[model samples]
Target chain A: MTIKNRSRITVFILSFLVWLALTHIGDIQEVIAGLIVAFIVSMIAGKFLITTEKSEHIVKRFFSAIIYLFKFLWEMVKANFHVAYIVLNPNLPIKPGIVKIKTDLTKDSAITVLTNSITLTPGTLTVDVNPETKEIYIHWIDVLSTDVEENTKLIGGRFEKLLTEVFE
Target chain B: MIRVIGMAFILIGITFDFFGVLGLVRLPDVYNRLQAATKCVTFGSAGILFGVFILQGFNNFGFKALIGIAFIFLTSPVSAHAIARASHRSGIPLTKETVVDQYQEDNELKDN
Candidate 1:
């Protein structure tokens, strides 16, 4: 099958799975309806759903994505505490600033995930992305370090690492 | 026991939401407020839904709660990013205490 056809099949299966999750397999009627809806949805929106070409290691990517989700949740919890501490402190101790960091990941989707992860994590919010240079500008609540490499490690390093495994 | 734990989670979620609102009122600038409010509230809501998941336990209601958690996680940051970008681009200046303004510098470089 051509890549386009393969992507449509992938979208179809995904939408059907989402349907199952939503309905929880109520009855044979629900299953039949889900199949039809998923088929129509895939045929209409399949191409837009997945931007990248098929990766060779689908199993590896799937596992990596699951691991990434758990890690992301943990990071998010820690981030709340960190923000809470800042909010509660009388001095408020925040040295907010915009800093630049670069990423090597080329795919649009990969870069997007990296950006979203940074925004949700501790003391950082993504402000702008330079498409030409692959550099991301972040508004950091606490300016821990001025050095680009140090700040990059402090902010985007961990997410970028796992994201590379899943997306690259 | 599970229901008790679920109640605890919901309480924690409410506490986080309170802090998020506190941060919204206390922080200095738009960006700072967005930082506190978005993170805490997103996690707060997710915590509440997760507690529902625990209370319901794999039934239809519980599964939908899990899906809601995923939806919140995926979408909140994107909206936060959009607001921050628009605020910065529209000449919303950072606070005096802000240490750096690299985005402004980059804009200047591009203009020149």
Candidate 2:
């Protein structure tokens, strides 16, 4: 079967299995319930989530997204320590500042993920995102430089690249 | 026997947690350190919490443990991203051991 068909089939099977486990229904009943629910959800998903423009890019996008997510998870683990050390130290040796970071990403979902990710760590908050300018304003617990160019390059640049690999 | 098993898992989990702490202190860079903290603490805490849950015999405490695990998974990644971005923006230079900086071209375009 084609990948698309297989993905759908896999989704069906998985949903059926999850339903069985979650509801503790018999197999036949599980299949019926799962299929009906899956069909309804898929229809809603197609209507609300999938666009014709995206449909063509869906397969390539999905795989790439998974790769990005794994990389992102790794980065997340790393950041936790950075924040932890910052927290544990008595000096509270943070140089806090607000900076504007410019990026190439304009996709809504990706931008949201990027912004939310920024907000999750200990020392930073994503205060604003501007798509028209493709920029984000971040409040960093430490601001080592006032140079706009340097700050922009540091904040959004690396993430924009990784996120590009992941989402765009 | 059950108590022994519970103790074993909790200690194993706590050991992992300490390893995560050590990783936080010792890893050479921001990226590497996060790796140690996220995976180690996640599994460690979950292991300990699950041990507690099992020991408690699936009471409300068990439910809370599961929820705690879920919360850790969700929040950990986002927080890490935030810290990294903040560091970079603050001009906290990455270790010399590091190389690539991808957002340069894109940033240039926005400035213009």
On lDDT, the leading prediction is 1
lDDT of 1 by residue, A1-168 (tens): 777777789999998988899895969999999999999988998887666565699899999999999998899889999999999999998999999998889988899899999999889999989889999999999998777888888888989889999988
**Candidate 2 lDDT score relative to the true structure:** 0.61
DockQ of 1: 0.76
Off by over 4 Å in 2: A1-46, A52-67, A120-122, A146-148, B1-112
When summed lDDT is taken over every stretch of 10 residues in candidate 1 chain A, the lowest stretch is: A46-55
The deviation in Å at residue A38 for candidate 2 is 4.1
Cα miss at A58, model 2 (Å)? 7.7
Which candidate gets the maximum DockQ versus the true structure? 1
Steric clash pairs (candidate 2) = A77-B34, A78-B34, A78-B35, A95-A142, A95-A143, A96-A141, A120-B79, A121-B79
Global lDDT of each candidate: 0.91, 0.61
> Alpha-carbon error at B9 in model 2, in Å?
9.4
Give lDDT tens digits, candidate 2, residues A11-124.
655555545544535457766777799766554442333221424465776777777667655655555555556545666455544566766776787787777555543344
